[model samples]
Target chain A: MQHTDNFQEITHHHDYDREASRKEVIRVTVILTVITLVELALGFWLMSIHQELMRHFIKGLICIFMLAKAFYIVGYFMHLKHELRNMIMTIVVPLLLFVWFIIAFLADGNSYKNLRNKYDPHHVEESKTKVDKPVHGEEHGAKKEGAIE
Target chain B: MAQAVPAEQKWWSGGKSPFNVEYGKLMMWYFLMSDAFTFGAFLISYGTIRFSSNNWPDPNEVFQSFPGLGSGYPLAFVSLMTFILIISSVTMVLAVQAGHAMDKKSVIKYLIWTIIGGLAFLSCQAWEWTHLHHEGAWWGSNPFLNMDGTKASTNFTNFFFTITGFHGFHVFSGVIINIIMLIMTINDVFERRGHYLMIEKAGLYWHFVDLVWVFVFTCFYLI
Candidate 1:
């Protein structure tokens, strides 16, 4: 029953520290509540701002605040902060790929948007008068090829 | 005879270190990390579509209506829902503390509180979905592409349903597990086993749900 003894030893002070734990939980609750309210306020302010660049800056700030809240929840409540360093990295290092996922997928989607706009019917029809007709002509094609080379 | 039979106690078994955590507990952490990636994929796709589109849906306008408040409240209802989930996380941690102390009474009480908070969040989602339905934005209607009047992307709302619905299901399952733990606490199951690690396991899950909601609220409502 070595494992049983180990668990009991780990939980030994659990009773004596109940009050302290309560205070800690409440402290975290207050901090989270405050941050949430601040995020909401700043979000509304961003919404009201007309400048696009300024709004983007504020949105970035809001993301930072959200990340801070996440840090608190994971570290304190989930007890990850108390865990050993290797275990922490085992969880966090993999999550960095999320940032990569966002960038990679967003880049692909933006390219798709660009492709869609470039091949749009109106633009395609407009370009047909300027470039395609001459490119189909043998003389112009030959001349353009010679000039390019 | 009792004194002669006594043996020395030790924390580690002189074996392989399993992520510096107990086996069952570390596995839960690993499960949560994997779950986080799934949610990460969903949110990343959401951002992809959102940035790719010209006229993305306005979360403020879409989330304006609150029950009994009629309209004009932007993000207020969603904020309240987030608040409830955060506080529930608090209750859950408290329950874990109680379990560590072998205090069954406090465990039952806090678990009930957590369960209530989860139910409240689900109900709020129902009201929000109902409001959207009446406005012609049901599961079938694409919010972004449907330009009848609400300047939104069909892809946006479809992802919204898929992601939030999945998260809500997690919360649903969390509450169910909490209830089972509550019953077990009442039955002295942990007492017989000489520990309350089950409560800690449940706390891990509840906190993970809270953690995911933070991202969802940011991706869905704030950003």
Candidate 2:
């Protein structure tokens, strides 16, 4: 806590007051632990039961709790709560785009799956009409003839 | 009489760190934020494939194996891992606190505890990976199959390995960094500077690692 050193002289502008930060840390720790416990309880309960009512919202509930834990870690442990508004927004606003990316990809991938399942249950044949001469190469010709036997 | 410099002339027209944090701490936060998006991309992709598939492996059934007790306790082991990482975060906070108070002794003490917690979590992961590999799950195999005989296991196993393995690497690096911090504290490196911002930076990283695990746990195990 002494300002004898030059580094301390420059950056030691604040007193050694960590009491508030310390208390917040402990509180956040307790909160995170409690939230995790609730998630675990819900996890096991839902795992044991197949109630349609619970199933309707279980994924949403799990996600909500997960976000809560994420916020606590970022806001308190990482000390973004005490940071400048500009800084917070700088980090946060850009992340929204990431969420958008997930949604977009999900839509695109599902569309592809639908198309594949609907149009092609199996591989498509290259020819619409039987070839008069035969389409198989010599190796395929021998294998095809052998398979027919 | 000297003229004042133009507004744009100063490297930082400077009020404080743009985030009002130490330059190093702010940089650390930015680094963590970037790292987060990388993890975000991974988990989000995993979720996409999982939901798209007709039948996905039940995480509860998949992760039931526990050490010294084979395959009965669903999530019992990962819950322990979560607790350990959270506890390590707490210790890391205390270490940062001790650093601010210039209590180097307590800082080192708490850091050692943090490192121990990290090691314990890593050991659990190592065991989990080994067990899963033995149980016919690996990068190339996805033992879970959907009705039409299409194996959903391939994407599941591959994503599981890549995502969790990436996370495991972060935890490994975090432990190594914590060890370095511990060494510096013991050697009075921060003591000479008279501030513990170094510990705080390391704490941000360690907490970020835990935070990422929270999502990984939800995506991989809880869901």
Candidate 3:
């Protein structure tokens, strides 16, 4: 008789636990919807101010906004926040480094492309300057058509 | 009479259960991480090319979807694609919730909804691709095409197709996987366990797919 009563009590407790988890799931869904709506609004707002922002801040603000949305998706939806710190660190630290690398590469690559354009007359005047005058007269100085070879 | 051999002595035991998530989940995590690096590489390469060229067409202009059959006003369909994917993510979350509660009926229903959303997103992407292809934009064949129909750059179209094409393949695979899970759920394979780890894992991958798109959208559309 005692075993039967204990079994009933355990089953009832399990039922309540499942119900609570269901409610939590619904709460999470609502939260995600609200955040995504906010992101949608922000996207439009940025577009409206794009011209002014581009001139003053160079579109970096848009990139920052994108990262913010990404963080919310990963941290909340993916539950990375509840994960072990080591696992979180493993993903986050490397991603941060990679992002920095991309930015550095873009900065350097753009500067180099600019420098090449300024010095390389072939890219600037490819149609008019048919005669290939090696700017430095070096073997590698042979200019290719339409910019970087 | 022989001494009893414990089940632990079996060759398969090896200190782990096959489906208790010891190896499966860990392997999934590793696969996802490597896949992420592949995406990162593509995006980084895209950045390199974008920075190297001048007079490159603004993504906002290039990605504008052809507005009707001949409306002459290109629309930003990428935003619509983003919205579809986000909605699919929500359905996926609901399916995971149902799976956790061992509600096989709701799990199957939500899985079907998620699959439908995936297919719709794929169709929209197909439309976007066909439009780009018709514009004589062979991958890397031309850098740029001016508004007046003159060629601008050859490098532009190359990266355009490569990056987006790679991401599309991931989405296609995701759709297929979800379909399989849906079928399995309907056939009562997952019902045996009273809990669906497969759905949870699929949800993780599906959410990652959405996450990747958000980055792709920002890079190739908004930027």
Candidate 4:
């Protein structure tokens, strides 16, 4: 077979270890499945608890599990872990921006909620009121008068 | 071209790839990174809206329906969807590995499995959206009340449909890319080129889809 120089340039020739790579893939798959199962179990457990603090804690735990799953998918499945360190850094460093992005947005949202509650008592009051029958899209015309009041 | 003179190699001396990967693969990685930011913005906006609201509907109460089994199974159907994507990702990994080994039969087998999984996940999503729409949930309508039985804002359904719809579009496109790759493989395009690098790039995309679903599941369903 004639091997072209263009082919060599376009593809990296790395040493392929069939047995080792297969074993690693299987290990990562198992780890990902177990993490997902644990996350599902926590989610189910969360439904039974009503305490605000407990719910928050479990949600936090679920978030951690979610991150773990992300790690495995990117690291093992995407083969980023096997890439050069420079390549990995380039992909990862930019993602750090999400930290500030999430913090600023969520903090502002909380502040907006507090400000609205303090100034617009009607909005606060309206959100808390319970409807005897939940309104559907089809019933919007019929309930227009009631909804206005 | 081998000159055994230097002790330390210059990785960035401008003759070799600095990252030791092909430019196409590197470009794919960057594209996926940008796509990640797009999703991150959507989810963060969702969290912002949820936090600013006086009360939010519990996802369990909202997504508590499984086809054929009726409603009341909270988090069950979505969990099934999650596993389906994960398993598909595993198949994608296998397909890429097969491509590396130049095993045409194994590559075709795993690619077919991955496509089937993608279609099944899309079907589940279609059923879900239909069921929710029947219950008066749409872009600007929400029939489900908050955990405290209080009225809910339209933002809940808005984000729900928008984010999941966007994600569904990704899955659809990913499947398309995989299908194209399968055809190319069948036609011996990569076999003639003597490398399966194209399949590797597609696998990266497929795995990225699964990664995004992880966060979406946790935020929308689990939490």
Candidate 5:
């Protein structure tokens, strides 16, 4: 096969500056690390909290941090920010679908749970009743059999 | 040829690459986009099930053990895994930068680091899985109880294994890809091709794997 020498001709090239690029990489790396450290700290803090509202709020904040970390990785490490606007749009537009996807699925799931709680008393009762010891593997199965008998 | 074009030349015209990227890179982006959805679906389903359940196991309780640390250290081991992946991603970016400069040696060096990072992450995951398995967590089994000590569903272990296992499969493939890139770099394939564009494509993939981990880590460990 003839290796086309026009490989450079069809592709658009960016001017390379090693020093500026290295500094940018280091900057992004530092940002990513700091964000991750903050996230870890939040995760630890979350362990101490028991309030439902507060827990939800902290989880939301962690999700936001996760998105920010994603932005840095894609925008810098993956070079999506440097791509042509047309390409960026092609990638970003489809991702918007996830918002609706998440909302609809979660809403439906919550509805299902509400319905189950109202109708399936057995499931609700079983889930609410605390067990003395969490059973495992064959032991859990054996206990179920004992209960059945 | 690119320089000869007028400054205001339409990028979307039939003659030019619309994204100003080579076809391989464009296709790789599209592929990653599709893969993002695949992972997104898996995670969304997991969320849906968790929402539908009356009670669920706490992630902190489930993933507290570290190798040689016995237990009780919540979020510690997974955080280490997260940093490993992040550092590997940095090395991947450096490799791609070196590729852009046609610096073969630097490219090789960074690629090796990235591969080691990938391997290290996989090993961490392996230890975590083995530890969980020893505790009787697997598909269709849950030795753990809900946060309130109520009976927990098997779905907890089910989704954990499936999603993390899937992500691990991606990392495993990524490591293999880097190895292939390393072998090519060693044989002077990119050197002869006059451009290290292939490395750039592989870099896109490596960074994407890292991107997925950010979500996986948050969903499984943090949230």
Candidate 6:
């Protein structure tokens, strides 16, 4: 195989030596396609089995599928698979934590809504008792009738 | 300049570098990694809200714009857009291959095709957005239809806007970059400069835009 001059080689790494990056990109693309299909299938299955599952679980599953696709793209096609261990971790670990933070926040909000439903069933009469009667108008007339009765 | 000694001379072998890649390629990897995370965050937040809510509208039911057919045929328009984006990714691969073979003409042709593909995808998206906006489908406008119909949530609509809008922005910028790089290559600028790394890096960026669209089509439209 013919090689470029040394000066030309100095600036560009050409790590895959031409043939390899070409082959690697195709391989990575195929992997991405397959994973995408599986994720779509999983999404369909989730939606079909239970309406609640689709509402509650499908979103999380989509996130996981997206994360997987992102991993392969970065690792292979973007050539992160060829980078330093520390650099790879530096990029990935924090992203994982960031996603976790979002999930936790959403979960807490959901649980708080549930707890409010369970512990504090708001009642209309209890709320009405605290309202001050109007000094004038139909409501005040109604209050007078209540006082008479 | 003293540390300019070549780091790894083996060419194909592993390096002392942490991921065994050279600095330029490693940085590209890191940039892509961060970019992936940014996209992930947007899509995941979309998922969180849509999941937490009840009776969200199905994507297929909402984005049913058919291509070359009567208006409002579900998902046809966006499906065509998805196919166009995938084909653009193929063109990008061809450009990279031409770069590897040092074939300037082929590289320019493929890049031009890729740019066209990007533009076509953007136009489709613009149409879809306009149609949705015209239909009174503003974000978070009662995600459910009625008691008998599927419950609609604004969360779904909001995500449909934010994530897809951000991705559309990326594709727009990608086309601009491809055009610039194409012009430079055809003028023999890259050849004279003896640097095809820019072409390769730009190819990665372009592919990423394509990759994200694939997921968006599935999660946001198909599912």
Candidate 3 chain A least-lDDT 10 residues: A135-144
State the lDDT of candidate 2 residue by residue for A2-53, as single tens digits.
5334233224436546877788888998899999999998898878766667
TM-score to native of every candidate shown: 0.84, 0.83, 0.75, 0.93, 0.93, 0.71
RMSD to the hidden true structure, all candidates:
11.3, 9.8, 10.3, 3.9, 3.5, 10.5
Clash list (residue pairs), candidate 2 = B142-B153
* Candidate 2 C-alpha lDDT tens digits along B14-36: 54333345667778878988998
Model 1 lDDT tens row, A11-115: 444346778878878898989999999999987987688687997888898889999999999988997886756678888898898888988998988886678
* Model 3 chain B lowest lDDT segment of ten: B14-23
Give the deviation of candidate 3 from the true structure as CA RMSD.
10.3
Better of 2 and 5 by lDDT: 5
What does candidate 4's lDDT look like per residue over A1-149, in tens digits?
A: 25444345335445667677789889999999999999999999998999999999999999999889998899889988777677889999999999999999999998999999999989888888997656545544232222111
Q: List ranges where model 2 is wrong by over 4 Å.
A: A1-16, A51-53, A122-149, B1-12, B15-18, B145-151
Off by over 4 Å in 1: A1-3, A6-16, A121-149, B1-20, B143-151
Number of the predicted model whose lDDT against the real structure is largest: 5
Decide which is better by DockQ, 2 or 4. Answer: 4
Instruction: Give each candidate's fraction of reference contacts reproduced.
Output: 0.39, 0.32, 0.18, 0.54, 0.56, 0.11
For candidate 1, lDDT tens digit of each residue in B1-223?
0111113532246643434456788889989999998988888878877666544556786678889989899888999999999989999999898887878888889999999998999899888887776665644453322112322325666777888899999999998999999889889898888778888988999999999999899888887
Per TM-score, what order, best first?
5, 4, 1, 2, 3, 6
Greater lDDT among 1 and 5 belongs to: 5
Runs off by more than 4 Å, candidate 4: A1-14, A133-149, B1-7
Best-to-worst ranking by DockQ? 5, 4, 1, 2, 3, 6
- The lDDT of each candidate is 0.77, 0.76, 0.65, 0.86, 0.87, 0.65
Quote the lDDT for B52 in model 3: 70
For candidate 3, what is the DockQ-based docking class?
incorrect
How well does chain B match by TM-score in each candidate? 0.88, 0.90, 0.83, 0.96, 0.96, 0.85
Q: List, residue by residue over B14-133, the lDDT tens digit for candidate 5.
A: 656666778788899999999999999999998999889888889999899989988998998999999999999999999988988889999999999999999999999999999998
Give one digit per residue, the lDDT tens place, for model 4 in B51-169. Answer: 88888889999999999999999999999999999999999999998988889989999999999999999999999999998887877667777889887767888889999999999
